[model samples]
Target: MKYKSFAVAIWGVVILLVILVPLPTVLMDILFILNITISLLVLLNAIYAKDALSMSSFPTLLLFTTLYRLALNVAATRLIIGQGDAGKVVESFGEFVGGNNIVVGAIIFLVIMLVQFLVITKGAERVSEVAARFTLDAMPGKQMAVDADLNAGLINEAQAKERRKNIQREADFYGAMDGASKFVKNDAIFGFITVILNIIGGFIMGMMQNSGASWNDILEKYTKLTIGNGLAVQIPALLISVATGIIVTRAASDEELSEEIISQLFTGPKTMFVAAGACFLLTFIIGRFFMIIVAAFLVFLGIRMQDSEQEKIKQDEKEMEERTVEEIRKPENVVTLLHVDPIELEFGYGLIPLADVNQGGDLLDRVVMIRRQLALELGMIVPVIRLRDNIQLNPNQYVIKIKGVEVAEGELLLDHFLAMNPGTAEEEIEGIPTTEPAFGLPALWITESQRDRAEMLGYTVVDPPSVISTHMTEVIKRHAHELLSRQDVQTLLDNVKSSYPAIVEELVPKQLSLGEVQKVLCNLLREGVSIRDMVTILETLADYAPVTRDTDMLTEYVRQALGRAITKTFITPDNSDVITLDPQVEQLILDSVQKTEAGSYIALEPSVSNKIMQNLLKLVEKVAQLGKQPIVLASPVVRLYFKRLTEQTIPGLVVLSYNELDPSVKVRSIGMVTCS
Candidate 1:
């Protein structure tokens, strides 16, 4: 590790020295060979890598290698123009490699340069640009996936962090590669220019000395040396350019390039068999011996591959069966079945695309937003909702489960928009009639073409995903209290204890246990109240717990303390109309109240309970007709029992005591509920 730093430092120093100071031909030859070796190494590394991230520093490597190669080009240029002979490496390349023919040497060098400049370097640069853009565009989705996995317990914190770091590294690598590709392109241009300048300068210098050499001789000597220098430099550049292309275009794979190519290209023998037949037919038109030999070899390889494939398939099946049997034999496997998720969303196969991110579904994102929304709105952390597909249900049907028990279900028409009349559409759009899944409102499933007309007609239009998301949101809200466990409550307390430690310490375990506090919080959530102000709630509980240990009574006091927020949630301060419980009804409920060791309940007779429910239902409808929420105003002593009594008849009936309303809010009685 210590020497590694110095090695790079020395490399940079060498690059500077090579450019600033002239060197001998022998040392230049060694550096040229080393340059070629490094380019070959980079190519091999790119080919063998399982994924791009394995060579994360490749962009920096490209920059460094480009600088070093250009420095070599500079030194070679100087030597050729000054000494008329760059080195033995260049001379050998100029003569033996090019057959000592000026025309042949020039053509060979131009071909290599063109192939590098036009084909490899150009393609690699474009690929790098696209890869960089796509990687950056996909960052948010990848981050959300990591968070989803973390939330679902599929991975722990350390694994999630590592995955996130890899994602960021991948983006940075591709982005850097986008810029580095330009270096490769310009390096090719620089080489071409360097070769031209050397030829021009060498010819001028050769003529100035008046060595009695003819123009042809002077031109020929310098031209051969320039082509040789170009060949030596362009060969390594070509190899590195090819490596850049390979790296940018490479997809994530479990095997090396060679293995992937072999496995993927030859997975089936049918193509090979077809190729053998084609080759055999070519024997008539082409050379009989060569075509026949190729045909026979192909047929033999195809046969062997066919047999190997069958054996591999059988082996895979046998291994799978053995693994299954082994898993079944393990006693702990049954224990896994007993564990249940707190919340789940099971849908039919047809609706799978609605939750699949690959198919443009945003249900998972919507689920995440639902969790966040509830955390803010209800002041409670909702459990992670598991999504899965069930083959047994109708294709478009979905079921919502709480604690492994199905609580609600709905269906969707994926290609249609749900258009509901908000009680103002003058004309109905032509479509299939269906009920809105979230609210059971009468709605039409209209085609995409009809969405505009429906919306123009004042019909509220929603697509399939929104329908499901809204439905899921409402389902979670209705059952938010049920999803809040004791652990969640503890988390809430811990969050509060950070800032307001004294209140939490005073109320929890001192005045009331954790379970009691949880019961009180759940009670508030059940009635659509926010528990965000835990400090206030704790303070109220601390003040009232000594007087009574009953959670139901404690919840009522907390509710009264949060009157301002509750009033803003369901009531208008300027002009609010509500149904008032009759004095006699309050007295009757108070008279029938029964206290037990566990809690309190209203001991009203069945007939009396039925009478009260009938009266309450009438008043609720009366208030609804006035375009106001049906809120029941009752004495604080009777609010809890009244809410419990009416919950079954009117599931979301809002019952608030006079003290639970903000003092500034004006309340007018629209009707009264009585047992008379």
Candidate 2:
């Protein structure tokens, strides 16, 4: 761990030194050899790797190794150009390895380039792309199968969940490999560039220095050395490319590639006998004594492979048994259960297609839009929703949950449209009678054929997804208060600190706790006033928090700060809102109120509470008839208590404090809540 932390810094320094300064011949020679050795080690590991994900760092490793090779090329080029020789390694390559012939060395280089660039690199890239596409495309179905097994009792909940997680990991692994393959392609291209620079630059230096006997002498010496240099680099590169090609194109096998090939190619003695006969015939026809020798070797290898495989199986079984016994000895209470997802949507088998992206389902996309919308409208960063299928549900039913607790649920007809009755219209549409889950509005679930007819009859037509989305929206909005934690408050403050740091620093801890601010925001959300304008809300808290630490009173002041935003959203185009709150009824409620540190509530007589409830419910009906949101404007002192009272009877009613209204917005008189 300590070494890895400093590895990048050390490499960075090495790269700078290699590029900026010339190195001694002996040191340069050692580093070059080290480079080749490391490349061989990486290549061998890639070949033996059983899974692509095991080589997940291949792309990053490719970049560093490629950089190191480039640096080595630069260092070696300087050494050879400055003097007649580079190092012992380069001298040996030019004399012994190249056979002192440029063409022989050049042909070796060309063959390595051709094989790595055209054969291995291109094939690996194509395999990566196709594998990525197929893996991603299969995820939805794979997840659905896991859900099926869980619901059918074929597997327990834990087993099915583990399978789903593995499927996701596999998809991610292939996707990463698709991008990593590009590094190998670029590395091959760069190898060609490196060779040209060395040869061209070396010749110019040799001629310019007058350190050679003649032009021919200079040409021959440099050509041998350059090709030898190219040979040293290209061999390892070719090996690595072949290893990469092997890793990306193979299927997952229980054994290593060599083991699997040996096991399958000559699994039984019958195949070995056939091979021995063929070799025996070759020896009789001509001087092919080696063929008979090879046949005997093949027969021996076949018998040995079976014995080795049997021993490996027994060893594996013994190890697995020991591990199982060790695991079983642990107490059952020590095993941990899974953590809960903050938001989850579970649908039944019939509704699986609605969440499957491959089948043209846009529900998941719509979920992205939902989070964006809430952030815009409510100033809240909603958590990611986990959408999965559940066989435990009825075919058409779905449930929405918060922290693993089912909060809201609804049913959808996959092939039908929900046509809701627009209250102003008297006409009735024929279909399956039902009520909208979000608001309990009178609605009918009609088939696709009746959609146009229903619209023609003045009904508001909506698709199944839209119906569910609306319910999801409302359920989330209604529960937004509970969702706001102290952490959520700190997040809001931190966001403000980015744009308005001084304001948050001065207000929090100095004036009130995070719980206090969270309470203020929750109070506003409970009344349907959007907290989207967080800047204003926080500023308002900062202004009055020092004077009074009461969250309820502070929430009222924050509401006033957000008056413009609230009125713009709730008021009509003419900037007008209709509300009812008779002063006499308000006074009577205030008179019955008792104050506490948290807030105040109306504790009226049973008869008085009854009178207030009846009139409020009547006013709600009246406002509904006028097609306006029902609101009751009151003093801040009584606003919170008034809301508590109405929620039990007329839950959709919007109760606002008078100061919450913007001065510029107009108000119209509606039915006043008088004690009738």
Candidate 3:
């Protein structure tokens, strides 16, 4: 680094010498002062440690002293020079003999030295940037390793130390190769052009000068113009020379020919005046008439290039899209419902009414009506309920087997169902068994109203006695006896313990429906036996449920269900009106609900209404905190209560009847809101 710095300093000194020597006759006094100041600073820093010198005081004093002396010396030099007259020589001799020019000469020397210092500083900065780039490029595989370590979160102190050592070793190894490559790729052409341009320009200028006339003289004679004399001539010449030098340097360094033209145009006004003045202006105007011809040629070239590139890109993209489509369309990628088993039932009632059938209207609306009816009957949200195929019962009575149940009942019946051929229980009556055959017992007795309801909904019912057979009757009796005795429950438990593994294997491969599994569990639970044993059995079975491939869809569905469950369990009536939830949670729910499947609606159970209200209140609070008002538009019942609460306090809350508000107005009225 030090050697490099010294080299830069040497170049800086050389540049200073070049600038100062040519203009010394006019600028020597000032230049001399600059040189002296730099010399003094160097002397001071060398003698005393850099820190010992007070940089602020010493530099300020040196600048002022240098400037004062330079001004005095330049004035003296100008007076002595006396516009290049004989008196100027006389004055200069007088000043030298009298010792009047010593201080001025010293100041001139210092100023030149200061300029050299500035040159050195700028050169050093350029070198530093180049060195940093070289260092970065030389470290082999550093970027890849850094990226890996960062991603894996394994970048500890020891790892970092090892990485640094590795980087340093690689840097040393590759640095030579990198430098050689860069020199071959960039420096060869650049260096060759630079040397060639320098030689050409130098030869041209030298020849022009050696021809008994300077380049400027030739230019003036040819152009029939003189750019004044003395400093005016010198300043323009200096600027032109500097600009030409830069262009030549760039050309020699392999800059484009177009760049050389631009450099020449900008370097001097003379070039522009000669080449692009009135004549060129007239040519430009004429060229506009031929623009259509030029445009046609350019457009054709552009289209050809664009078409080639675009076609290549299109081909690549098409291949990629095809591959992706193939992967997504694979049969294994489809999400199938786990299982679906149909449950058959018998009805003695008449055929269902046409009005009850889901036809000529939206499926959701019909589902809503069905749900409402079920809710009215059950006094709660029925988790699962669906219509099944009709059959005739032995009793000639409307009968239904609750084949598919979602929640567990017990183990004995579950095992029997799994067995696939479960026989019924029987019992003998002591005095009534005298060759008189009995009828099969019905699971449920249908009332006339129930029968009418069933028939209205497109169902057929069987009467009680017509279909009963003696063998079936005996089986029914035996089953009833076993059920009452709880012996069947024990048998089911034993059966489950023995056959659960086999049942699970069969179910898993068959992809049994959730309904079928639920029914088996419900029967076992209802049998009043082996509830714990049945849960264990079903738990084993549940492992066989179809594994979903759409993680995002499954996750979102589970999240929504969990959110609803949380709101129901944690949100209660007491805090429904007062409790508040975080706005973030509410927003999450809102966004999730919006993105839910088109036909699905997130139904908030009545039990969870208060919690949702609390969340809305929280949103209102947040809005208020942000210096905004919350206007709630709700059903009449809600509006009335909210209005009553806010009436006694500040009128910060506004409650509007939902029916009376415009849809757009309603949306703007609240920070957040919930609707049924």
Candidate 4:
């Protein structure tokens, strides 16, 4: 590697030396021949490159080749004008082409210069400029697309990184090529001026040295050498310019230019047969014997191409069948719900504009932020969500699915704004009426024109994407406990095992299994508690798991340990109302609560259960009138049993134990639950 790098460094020094110091004729010929070889290699690489990034270094290499050619031009001018002897290459060209006429040599040089400067170089420069501008302009959208794929779990972290790198490389390559094009344009102008100057200086020198030399002799000797030098430089420069044009204009593709031309252009046999018929007709009129040969070859090639295409298709089908047979033999694929994402957000075709990053929608980015927020607030990692479009639904509808089951669906006018009454609005805002899915709030789907007025009317305004995102957040929160599997518990343990290894070592498997831990965590999350403090919960479990293996019991113990945090969360700072069970009602429940091997259960008569539920509903309504949260403070013995009893019949009742309330919190008794 060092030797190769040193050799490249040495090559660059030689180009500089060629300009500052005079070189031997033999060395000049070698460098001149090497330049032509390098140009051809670059042109061939461009023709065969599968895409522009395959030849990402072409722009830098172009600059070096252009510089080397310019150095050689300067060196050759010095040799011809100073000593009237450039090299054998210049001498042979002069004698062969313009042995008697200088006009022919000059015209040939003019033609090559014009073709390079006016055509190839000019076109390549324009292409490079346009490619650079467009690539840069599309960069933000491309980056957002990669990010969206990452959030949607279509690709993993490593794949997303590779994709992002390719995007950046494409932008960089085009920008570099834009600047590199200037080298070719300048090289063309420099080559023309160098050739003309060398010819004029040589003529002046030859006339001065040989005073009796005729004008024809001086002009003939000088014009031929100048034309030879110009051809040596311009021919390779033209090839480099063609390569640049090819590199800049080439679109990304999976196949090389040769394969693409054959696969796409010649894939159909009809065009080939039509061309063959045309060629056969041409042979009847003009004696183009080659036309008949061409016609025959086209007919043969058409048959061969069709046969090859059929073979490829048959091979592909055979491979697909083999794969299907293999898949059938394996039972995993048949029953593998493991590959299905835990959560998925599918939107309709018209709602697609809300998720597309190119259309200024960042729903995917918002999903990422929501995941991070859930992890912090809920203390469990939400699984990566898969996003897709569904055409079977309404165009403006979106469905939220949990484990492939649609749990929630909502519709949005993507062009309109959602204006929610902050519950304090005195009058209704004029627009389409819609219910906010997340909280079931009364909201209006207002147009852009009504957005400003709605806000002015004391309404909280949100965009369509925010509406969908809000709905997704609430649905996920509602189903969080069901989403917590044994796998998730193991993951949680593994995450914290690194920091508190001893706590995890003693608490899990030794005391409680992962399933027990998952159940306990689910119990806490069922009531919307943040388990971010996993260490404390694990410690509490470690202390109590020996006596009782019941998850509900373990969860109650964990809650008491987290009393201060819990009290701070739901209770207001003003130390307001604390709704407690009446002593007579509490005693009735505590006396009925029965303890057995499989946890505890509270059994009561139908009349007693009915009276207790009626009194509880009245107390709940009284708390609502006072603008305070309804929390039933009771003894620890029946709190767990009461939790299960009220779960089905009473939806919004929060049952808390006396030990779960912090002493720092002050409270006044709002009312009592009784059977009066």
For every model shown, the clashing-pair count is 0, 0, 55, 0
Q: Could you list the CA RMSD of all candidates, in the order they appear?
A: 12.7, 17.9, 29.1, 13.8
- State the TM-score for model 3: 0.20
Which parts of model 1 have CA positions greater than 4 angstroms off? 1-324, 573-575
Count clashing pairs, candidate 1. 0
What would the TM-scores of all predictions be? 0.55, 0.55, 0.20, 0.54
lDDT of 3 by residue, 1-676 (tens): 6598586466455444533434334444344334444445534342332221112133233233333333333332233233221122222432433233434533443343333333432333344345446656756567577757867888876777777775665444233322322321232233233323333443454455458767653332211111011111122222222222222122122334455565555444343344334444555678764554444444554465456668878999999999889977888656543443222223332322211345332322443554465334221222232333244422223332233322111111101111000122232111111111232122233444454444444433333222222222232222221222233333444456476666544553265444444434333222211223343444444443466322232222222223333233222343223222234434434443423443323343444545556556677776655534454544532343344334444233544444433333213333444432
Better of 3 and 4 by TM-score: 4
Misplaced by over 4 Å in model 4 are: 1-333, 336-340, 625-628
lDDT of 2 by residue, 212-323 (tens): 4688778777877776666666666666667667777767776787888876887776678778788888888877789889889878876776677788899999999998
The C-alpha local distance difference test score for the whole of candidate 3 amounts to 0.36
* Candidate that beats the other on lDDT, 2 or 3, i.e. the better one: 2
Range of the 10 consecutive residues with the lowest summed lDDT in candidate 2: 572-581
Q: On lDDT, who's better, 1 or 4?
A: 1
Model 2 error, position 79 (Å): 35
Say which prediction, candidate 1 or candidate 4, comes out ahead on TM-score. 1
